[model samples]
Target: MAVGFAVLLTVGCGQGPQAQFSVRDTTEELLSPAQKAVKKALDDGFGTPHELVAWQRLPVNYGGVHGAVGEVLADGKGITAKWEGDAAGVTAGAPLLWISGARAAESTSVDSVGSFDAKTKTLTWSGAAEPAPAAGDKLVIGFGQTLKTGRMVYMKNCMHCHGVAGDGAGPTAKYLNPLPRDYRSGVFKFTSTLTPEKPTRDDLTRVVKYGIPGTYMPSFLWLGGKETESVVEYVRWLSMRGEFEKRLDDDLSGDFSQKAIEESAEKALAEFKAAKADEKPEKPRSAGDLKKEAVAKFTNETDGYEKTEFPGVIDDTANFLAQGWTHGEDPESLILPSVPRVPDDAASRERGRRMYLSDKGKCYTCHGIQGRGDGAATEDFWKKPGSDEVYERRGLHDAWGHPLMPRNLTLGQYRGGRRPLDVFRRIYAGIKGTPMPGFGRTALKDEEIWDVVNFVMSLQYQSAPAPAKPAEHVAESK
Candidate 1:
C-alpha cells in the first residue's frame, strides 16, 4: 500500500509507464470519480489483500480534462493512484476524501467546499477490549483510518488544554490552577517511579488507561483499548515532534551565547538533557522520609519548596500542594482542594432533601440515602486487579488533596464549596473529570439546577425531636 497521502490529484495516468490500457468503454460503465479511483486501484493491483483506502473524495464528474494527462475523465470517472510496487492493506473505509470534477461543457472546475472525516473506522465499529464484534463488512483499518482516529482523539481529549500542537499553551491554560503539562518541556510528571529515563509507551498507556489520579485528566477507559493504544501512540509521536520544536525554538532564542551556539547542536542538546535528568524523576520516598523532609522542607529558609510542590504547601495562599516525594497506600494523601461541611440553610435543605430521594436526581444511589458517601454503590463493592478483596475505593480527591467523600448533605460540607453559586457551578460544570456528570448537558435546566443547589444548601436544617412512639410508651408504662 502506498503509505502517504497528497493534497493534489495530479496522478498522471497518461504520463506513467503503466499508462491506462484501453479501458473498455462499457455503456453502463459510468463510475464516480471515487469509484474510478477504486477501479484504477483495483485494475492496477489495489484490490483485496491490499484494500482501497480513499484519503478523500474525488469530484463526481471530471469530463472536461480530456486534454489533461492525470485529470479524472467524464461524469462517473475517478482518478486512481498506483503504488510504486506491491503493497499491504489499505485501511478500511478510508477517511472521508474530497473529490473534484471539471465541467467539460463549461470548461472549468469547482473547489472542494466541504469535508468531514469518518468518526470511527468501519472495522472497529463493533467494539474493543474483549473482541471485535460484528460490524459492517465495509469497515477497514490502516493509514487513513489511523489518521482520522488520531485527529478525533486530539479534538476530544487534548485540544482544550494540550493545544492543537500538543503544547501546554491551550486556550484554557491561563485559568487553570496548576498549569497544563508543557509537553514541549519534555518533563513528564509521572513516569514509572522504577525507571529513571523518560516514561515508556506503557507508562503513557497506564496514564491513558487509568488516567492521572489528581488532575483534570479524565479516564477514557470507556473508550476502550484500541482507541487508547492509538491515542498513546499518537501522543508519543506528538511528544517527539514537540521536542523537535523545542529545539528549534531554543536555537532561535537568544539564550544561546555566540560561543555556545557555535558548538555542535549535539553537544548543546546532550547537556540540556543531562542537566534536566535528575529534576525529571522523583522516586517515591517512604512515609518516614516525607515526614522528616516535610519538617525540614517547611522551614521558611527552605521556602517550603525544598521537596516538591503539592497544594496548600505554600503558606498564606489560597493555593497549595504537598511537599516532597511522598508515596503511600493511603488514598487521602494526595493533592486536593480541602472542603468543609455545609453550614445550616433551612429552606434550601428541604428542597435538597426531596431531590436526594427523587428517582430523577438519584443522588442516593452512590452517595447513600443519608448523603453519607457510604451508599450501596460503595459499601462493599470493589474494582481490583483480578482479586476477591475489594479495594472498595474510587480514586477521587478534593481541593485539600484528601479522599473526596460525597457531600454528606446532612453534614452540609460540599466539596465544591457550600456557597449557593459554588454549588450551582458544580451542578452546572459537574467537576470536569469525574463520575459526577452535569445535568445541564441533558434535560435538566438552569433553574432546576438552582433548585437542587438550593436544596443542597438547605441540608443543615435542624428540627425539634418528634414525640415518643406508642410502642415505646406502652413499654414505659408497663
Candidate 2:
C-alpha cells in the first residue's frame, strides 16, 4: 500500500519539477524608489513589457502651422499621416498613436495602435479603433516615447528570455546555454546593415520571424505580419528604455543608491505619522493625507538631488536615445561594396580559400582549415564579460556568454541570408555580438571580401568528401 501511494505521488508530480512554487519577481526591485517612480511614470505613460499604455499625445506643429490633427489613416501593417504643414522633420518608422485627453493621465483610454508607415503615410492597427477617435483627441508621433501594440506581443512571446526591460536577463535567462541579447547597448549581431548602426526594422523583423540557425532563439513564424511588427516595435521600445537607464546610471551612480531612497521614504513616513499624531482631535489627518505627504517629500528630495547634480541628464538622455535608433535607419549608413562580387568560378573560390587560410584573414583560428568548424580554439574556455570568472565548458562563446561554434561552411546553412549582398555584409561588417570581425575597407578591400563571399556561397553546393577506409588486417587467412 505504501509503495502504491509513493508511486501515485511520483506520477502525480510528473517527470519534471512541479509548477506550484512562487518565485519573487525582481525585475524592478533593485531600482531606487525614485528610479522606480520614473520607471512607473514611463510604464503608465508609455506602457511596459507587461501592459499596454496609451501614447502621451503632443501638440503638432509644422513650419508656421501649429496644432493640426492632420489626416491619418490605418492599413494592414502600417499607418500613414499627412498634414498641410511641414512634416519634413517627422522621422520614418517612428511610433505614433492618438489619445483623447490633453494630458497623459487624462488620456487613460487609447486605441490599439501600431507603428507609423512612413512610406505610405498610414497608421496601422491590429483592429479598428473602438469608439473611433474624436476630433479633440490629439495625434502623438515620435520614436522612443510611445506605447505601442508591439509591447503586448513582446510581453507574451519574448519577456521570458529577453526580460521586461529587454536586458536579456529574464527569469529563464540563467538556465539558457547562450545568454539572451541585452539590447541596452542597442547593438545587434547578424545584420545585413552596416557597422555601428542598429539593424533595420526589416532586418529585426526577419530575425524575429526566422530564428537564428545555431542559436536557441526560436522563430516565431506562426505570428502574422502585424504581430511580428508589434514585437519589433516593443523590442525597439525596450532597447530605448535600457539605453536611457544606462545613461542615467552613468550620470547618477555616484550620487544615489536604493538604500538612500528607502531611508528617505522611511523618514518621510515617520515624520508624517508624527505630524498627524500632533494634530488636534477635531482636525485629525486622513490616511490619504499622510500618504500624499510622504510621496511629496520623497519626490522633492529626489528632485532636488537630481537638479543639483545632473540638471540636463533627462533631456540629454532622451535625445541621445532617440537619435541612436534614428541614425540606424539613415540611408547613408548602409555599406555597399565598391565593386561587384567576383564571379563564383574556381579561381575565385581558390583565392577565397587562400584568404581564409592566411593570418591576415585568420578564418582558420575559429573555423577549421577545411571549413568544418572544428578549429583548435573551440577547446579553450572563454571568459564572460564584466566578470572575473570564465565559462565552465570549452568552446567558442559570443558576447552573451553562450557557447558558440564557428559556422560549418560545409553545411551550407546561412543564418543571415544566402544572397550575394548578404554574404558580402557578413564578411564586411562581421557578425555583431559574436567573435566575427568586419574585414571590409580596413583589412581587406571590397574585392577581396567579395572573393571570400563567393567562396562561402559555393560551400553549400560542393559535394562532401567520402569517408576514408580503415587499414584491413591480414586476418591470418583462416
Candidate 3:
C-alpha cells in the first residue's frame, strides 16, 4: 500500500514556478494619526517589510555585534580592521562596527573604505572618524542597513500560506489543518529551547530549511546558505512589525476610538461657527477644514498622552519582545532529560503502556487505547483561548483556531523529529500553541518519561503480546 501510494503521488504531482508578487498594506486603517506616528517611528528605527534597517552591535561591553570582532588598525584616513580567523568569509559592502563610545562620523560602507586584502588579512577604511577608537578597543565588520536579501525569497516561497505580514492569514492559510504560524506573537511551537523564549535564528532556520513533517510546510533544502539567511531576516522583520502593532494597539485603544474623533470634529466645527458668527462678515467653514482642525487637536492630545504614558509602555514592550528572542539562545533554556532513554525492550514497553492507560498520565483520554488518534476528545467540544465561547465544531483546536488532531503514533511518523532527543523534548516542553502539555520534572518522574518515550517509539510495531493467564492455585491437606 505504501509503495502504491508513493507511485501515485509521483505520477500525479509536478512542481511549478511561483506566481507573480503583489504589494499588500499591513496597517489597520482605523488607527489614528498618533497611533500611526508611533508605528512609523518603530518602522523607521527597525526596517519595514519593503526596506531593511541598518544597525551595528555595540562592543561586548556595549552589546556585541552579530558576529565576532577582530584586530583594529588606526590609519591616517580612519580605521581598518581584519576579520577574525576566517578572513576569506568577509564580503565586500558589509557593515563595519566600532565601539559604542567611538564610532565613525557617518555610517561607513565596506566598499567605500577599500577592498579587503586576503594576503595582508585587513580592510582599510580611509573615511573620517567622529570619536576615534582608543588602542585595544575592539572593532568589527558587519552588513549594515541595506535591503534584506530574504524579503524576495520569503515572498516567493512563504507568502501564500504564512502571508505577507506573517500573521498566518494568507490566501491559503485557512485551508491547512494546523494553521500556519502567526509570527506577530513572536512565539514558535517547536524548539529545543524552553518556555517564554522565542526560537533562535538557528531554530527558525532549521524549520524553514527542513520543513515540518505531516504538515503543509514543505522543505526548502535546495536554498543556499545566503538565501536561507535572507528568509530568516525577513521572517524576523515581520515578527518585529507584528509585535510593534500589538504594543501600539494596547497603548492607544482606550482614547483613540473612531467615535471620539467624530465627536471632537463636531465640537471643533461648532466652536468655529460660533466664533465666526461674531465677525462683521461671517466666513463659512467646510467639512474638510473642520476635519483638519480636529485631526490637529487629536494629534496634540496623543502627543501629550504619549509623553506622560508612552515612554514606560514602549520600554516595557521593547524589553519583553527582545528578551523573548534572546532567551532562546541561552543554554540554560534547553531541556536535557536527567536519565538516559529507557531501552526499547518488552519490559520497558509494558511499563510505558501501563502508565499511558493510567489515570495520572491519561494519554488514552486524547490518543485513544490503540494509539489511532481516535480518543474521545476528538468528539468533544473545546473552548477557544482568551474567550469563553465554545468552538462551533467538536475537536481539539490549536492557538490559531484550526481543528487539531492528536498524532497517530502507529504510522511511525514524527513531525518534530525522528531522533529520541527530539521526541523527548516534545514530551518535556509540550508543543507550544497546542493542547500538548509538558510532563517533565513537575508532572512525571524522569524514569517514567523515558519509559513513555520507549513505549511511544515502540508503537510503530504491534502491541506486545498479553501476559499468559496464570492458573488458579489450590491448597491440598494430607
Candidate 4:
C-alpha cells in the first residue's frame, strides 16, 4: 500500500493564505433583486465556512457564553458584563462574541481583565467597540470553535472530494464513477437506520473509519478520536446549513424567481397597453416600473417572512434534523435478524438459489440471471421521482439521479461491508438513497433472507455459476 500527502500552500511571498467557502450553484443572473436579498440575509446569518456564525437556534453546540452587558467604559477599551454562564475557564485571550445591540455579529478577544471579579464585572479588549457595548447588550464568547476545528480537519482531509460546502462538487469529484455523496441532501446510502431516518453519528463514523468498499472513499482509521468526532460534527453542521439554504430557497423562489418578475412585468405591460388603446391618457409603464413594483411587492410580502416566518422555518428545520439523527440511534430504528442465520450448507444455498430465481425475491431483475449485474433493468427507462416523466438515461438511478448499476454479486465485493450482518442489514433496511428496496418484515421472512444471503455469498466461489434446473425452480426467472 502507498500513502500520498497533499500539501496545499498559497505561494504568496509575503501574505498568508486565506480561504473562503464557495456559494451554491445558483447564479446571480438567474436571481432577481428579491432573491439576492434573501441570499444576503442567509449569508449574514450563517456566514461563510471560514468566518462561521454560531446561530443559537441550531442544534450545533458552538460552545460559548450568553452574557449581557453591564456598562460601557468611558475610555475606548472594553465594557463590564454580567456573564450569564460561568466564565471560570475562560483565559485572558479568549473570544468575546457580541450577540446584540450595536456590537451584534461581532467578536473581540480578551486583552486583559486582571482577575475574575464577582462584585465588579469588567472586560478589557484589544480594540474599542465603536458603539460601545451598551447596558444589556447580549454577547457570546468562545463560540464556533468546534465548527472551526471541524472545518480545519475537513479541509485538510476530506475537502478534495466532499467540497468546502459538503456539496460533493470538489475538484476531483467529476472524475469518480460513483459520484461523491452530497451531504446537502442529508441522505446517506449505507445507514443502519430504518427507512426515512437520517444516519446516526456511528453510521458516519463507521463510513469514515472503514470507508466504503469498491469506491474511492478510502479508510481513514488513522484519524485520532477527537479528529473523528470533530469531522462528524462538522459534516452534520454543513448538512444542516445546506438543508436550511435549500428550504429557504424553496420558500422564497416562488415570488423571487426571475420568471416571476418577468411574468409580473408582462402583466403590467399588457394592462398599460390595454389602457392606452382605450383612449385614456394613462401613463405608459416601462419594464423598470414593473420591476420596481415587483421588488416592492416582494419586500412587503417577504418582510413578514424575514421577521416572523423565517425564524420559525429555521427552528422547524433544526428540529427536524435533530429528530431524524436522534431517532436513528434509537434501538427501534435498527435492523436485526429475528433468528440466527440458517446453516450455510447445500440445502440452504439451494433454497436461496430457488428464491433468487423466483418471483418473490426477483433479485435477477437487477443482478442478472447469472449475477453479473448486467440485468435487463439496466436497459430499461425509470421514472423520475414524484413525476410521470422518465429519466433521460437508460438505467437504474439512485436518489442522487446518477445512473446506477446494481451490485455484481459474482465479483464478491459489497460496498456496505462483506460481513454477514452488514449484508443482512443491507437487505433488511435497504440501502438508503438507492433503488435497493428493503425486504425486512414486509416482504421476506428472516429465514428466507438468510437463505438469500447464503446464496449470494456462494456466487463468487463457484467456478461457472448457473441457475437451478427446471423442476427445482419454484418461480419464473427474470
Candidate 5:
C-alpha cells in the first residue's frame, strides 16, 4: 500500500488546501494520514459534476437581503429567508415567486452598495459597509453615455422581475408567481450536478441557456448564443455586486449598530434645533472610482483562458448525452402497464401501441391527435384558472414586437435532458408553466408512465449521433 498527503488549498480554507490524509484508489495503495481526510470529504459528495462540493454542509453565511435573516438546515438540503420582517407587510408586498440560487448567489447580497435603473425600472440599493463609490449611482444616470445595448438587454428582459437595481425587488415582483432573482444576493438554484454553492459560471450559463421548464422561465438558448453573451455578462456583474453588498451589510450590522445609533441620539428640543443644520449630508458617488472598479472586474474575468472554437452540432449532442448518464432524473423500478423493455418483435410493439392508444391511458389529448403537438386545442389553449399569465405580466417587447408561444414538446428538443429517466421525470412531475399536472399519484401508474415513456421515446424527437468514419477506408479514400 502506497499513500501520500493530499494538500488542497480551497477558496474557503485559509491556506491552500492541503489534505492531511492519504487516499487509496486502485492505483493508490498506502496513503498518508493527510490523504485520508481529503478522501473522506470526497466520499461525502465528491464524484458529481458539481466539482467544488464533495459533501453537504451548512453555509457560513446565507442572508441575501441586507439585514435579512435566513436559516440553513443541518442536512444542507435547503435554506429559506424572509424578505421583510413585517409579517403583514409581507403579504401586501408579496412577490409572485422567488428564484432560489445556491449559497454563492446569496453571497451577492452582501456586496451591492448601489443600483442602476433604466426607463420605468428604478433599481435601488443600500451601500455595503466601507463601500466604494458606484458607477450606476453616478455616471450612467448623470453623465448619460452608458451603452444602450448593454443596459437595454438587462432592463428589457430582466429588470422588471430581478429588480432594476438587482436587489431582487422590482415593482412587478408581486405579479410574478416566482419572484425574479435578486442577483444582488448571488444565490442560484439550478446547477448541473451536486454543487456546494452558487453555481459556477458554466452552471449559470447553462441555466440562462436552458431556462427552467414547466415554469414561468422558458428556454433562452436561442437568445444566448455569442451575441447575447453580453446579457449574461451584465447579469453576472449585477449578481457580484448584490452578493458583496449583502455580505458587508450583515457583517456591519452584526453588532447592533443600527439600534445603538438610534438609541444614542439626543431628543431634546434645543439639541434638535442645534443639530438640524449639522445632520449628515448625502454622500455623492464619485464617477472615477466606479469606472476603475468596473474596469478591474472586466479585466480579471477576461484574463482567463478563452475557448477557441464552436464544437458544432455533433460534439454538442455527444457532450450532453455523456452528461445525461448522471444528470437524468431519478428513476424507479416502476411496475405498470407501460412497456419497460426494448421490444424484440412487432408483437411487443403492437401491445405497446395498444396501451398508448387504449382508453385506459388515452395519452393523446394534449400530446395531439396523432402524437404531434398541434392538437385541436392548440389554438384554443387557455391559462388554467389558478395559474398566472407570465407573458401578460412581462408587458415588454422585442425589436419586432411579436409574442412567443409555449414549447410544443412534440418538437423533440427536450431541454430538460434527453435521457430516459429525464423523460420519465417529466412524465411523472409534469411541467411548471402550463396546466400539466404530476402523474405521480394522479392518473398514470408507474407502469403506465413507462408505457408512455416507451411510446414517447419511440417518437422521432432527437437527431441521430453522427457516424464515425472507418479508419481503414479513410486513408485509402484520401
Candidate 6:
C-alpha cells in the first residue's frame, strides 16, 4: 500500500514543514539580468512541490485533463468550458489549474463538477477562485496532481537524503559513503541507454523498485506500480529542470561572467583612448568620462542580450530537453547485445581474466589486479574534467567530484545488478558519469565482452587471497 499523504507530510517533524522546493546554489552575482529572467520563468512553470504547474513546455507526463474557460458565471464563482483528454479524471475534489488570463498558472481545488452537456460540449465547476476564470482562459483540471502526489512520496522517502532540489545534499547525505545522486546534473551512473543519453523510465523504475545492492539506497518493492510510476515521473521532471538551469548558466556565462564584464570594460576604454589619440584635444577625455562611457557600453550590450536573444536561447534549451527526453524512450537509444552471453565455463572465465589484466581492458588500473579495488592509480593525482585544476586528494572521483573507489569484484555486490546481461550492459556502455569505459564494438567484440562478464561473475567464489604488494612499493612504505 502507498503511504498516506498526511502521515508522509510530517514524517520527520513535530510540526510539518511547509512544502517548498529549494533553488540551486548559483549565486545571483554570477547571473546576468537575462539569466535571472530565465530562472524566474522556470520557477513559475515548475512551481513549488505543492503548487505544481504542468508547464506544457516540458516532456513530463502530468496526467490530467485540460481545457479553456468558455464563459464566466454571472455570480463570479464558476465557469463552463470544453474539456479535452481524460475527461473522466476531472471529477469533484480534483484541482483546477488556471493557465491563462488574470489568475494564470494558479490552481485551486474543485468543490463540485457539473455533468458534461454533450450538446454544448462543456462542463461547469464551482469554488475555483474568488474571481472566476475569464473566457478563453486555458486551464487544466486534475493536472499535475501526479507531481504533487510524487512530491509527497519523495519527501517522505527520498528527500532526507536527496534534498528538495535533488542536489543530493540532504541532511543525512554528508554522512553516507557514496552520496545520493544529484539529479540536477541529469546524469545517472547506471543505465541501459547509450553513454550520451539519459536513463529511460524503465531504468529508473528498476532502480527504485530494486535498490542498489551494496549502497544505502534501499528497495521500495512494496510501493504499488502507480506510486512507483508517479515518483519516477517526478524524478525525471526534477532532472529535466536541473538540466535546463545548467544549460542556461552555461550559455549566459560566456558573455555575463565577471571576467567578461571586465574585459568588455577594458576593451571599451582602449577604443576610446585610441579614438581620442587621433583627436589630439588640449585636454583629452577625462578618466571619469572614459569610465562612464565604458560602463554605459557594457550596460547596453547586456541589456540587448537580455531583451533580444535570451528568450530564444531559453526556448531552444527547452526544445532540446524535450526532444532529448522524448528520444530517450526510443528503442534506438537502448544498448542491445548483438550476441548471447558466452557460456560461463572455466575457459570463458580465464579468457575474461586475461581481458581484465590486459592494457586493452585496463580494469586493473582502478580495480586492483586481483579484483580487490586497491589499484595504484587511486594514490595518483588526477586532473578534474574540463579544467586543469588537480584534485586536492588522491583517488578516483565521479562526475560529481565525490571520491569513488572502484568496485571490489570479490565482494560479489554489483550496484547495477548482478545478472549477466546487466554486467554485459555495464561493459557495453561503460558506467555513465564514471571512469568505467565501455568495451563495446570498438574495444571488444560481443563474445569477448560476455567472457569478461563471466570472469567478473566468478570473482565472488574464488577463495584465493589478493596478491602481495611489489618489493619497491613495500620498501617505500617502510
- Ten consecutive residues with minimal summed lDDT in candidate 1? 316-325
What's the TM-score of every candidate structure? 0.28, 0.62, 0.74, 0.73, 0.30, 0.76
Task: Compose the digit string of candidate 4's lDDT tens values, residues 1-478.
Answer: 0111111111222222235555554424224654566566556556765456655555565545557878877785666778777876445656655556665533332222333455567776545446566788766566565566667778888888988788888889999979988888888888877897877778888989999889999898999986887788788878877776666666666655666657766886677767756675556566566566656665565464455565576557666766776777788888778999999999998888887777777788888888889777999999999999999999899888898899999989988878888888888888888898888887789999999999999999987897554334653442
- Candidate 6 global CA lDDT score: 0.74
The sequence of per-residue lDDT tens digits that candidate 3 reaches over residues 28-80 is 43335755666654644454443444322100011112232245554534334
Tens digits of lDDT, candidate 1, 304-340: 4322332211121111001111221123322222233
Per residue, candidate 2 scores C-alpha lDDT tens digits across 293-388 of 444544566555434434456556666665666777777677788887788788997777667766667776677766778777888887777787
In model 4, what are the clashing residue pairs, if there are any?
99-139
Candidate 1 displacement at residue 36 in angstroms: 40
True-structure RMSD, every candidate: 24.6, 16.8, 12.3, 9.4, 27.9, 8.8
Candidate order by decreasing lDDT: 6, 4, 3, 2, 1, 5
* Model 4 deviation from the true structure expressed as Cα RMSD, one decimal place: 9.4
- For model 5 the TM-score comes to 0.30
Q: Best to worst by TM-score, what's the order?
A: 6, 3, 4, 2, 5, 1
By lDDT, who's the top model here? 6
Give the per-residue lDDT of model 6 (tens digit) for 287-369.
44544543443346556566567678878888888888888888999988898888999999878877777766778778888
Indicate whether candidate 2 or candidate 6 has the larger lDDT.
Answer: 6
Cα lDDT computed for each candidate against the true fold: 0.40, 0.59, 0.62, 0.72, 0.38, 0.74
Pitting candidate 4 against candidate 5, the one with the higher lDDT is 4
Q: Write the per-residue lDDT of candidate 5 for residues 26-62, one digit (tens) a residue.
A: 1122112212322333333222111222111211111
RMSD of 3: 12.3
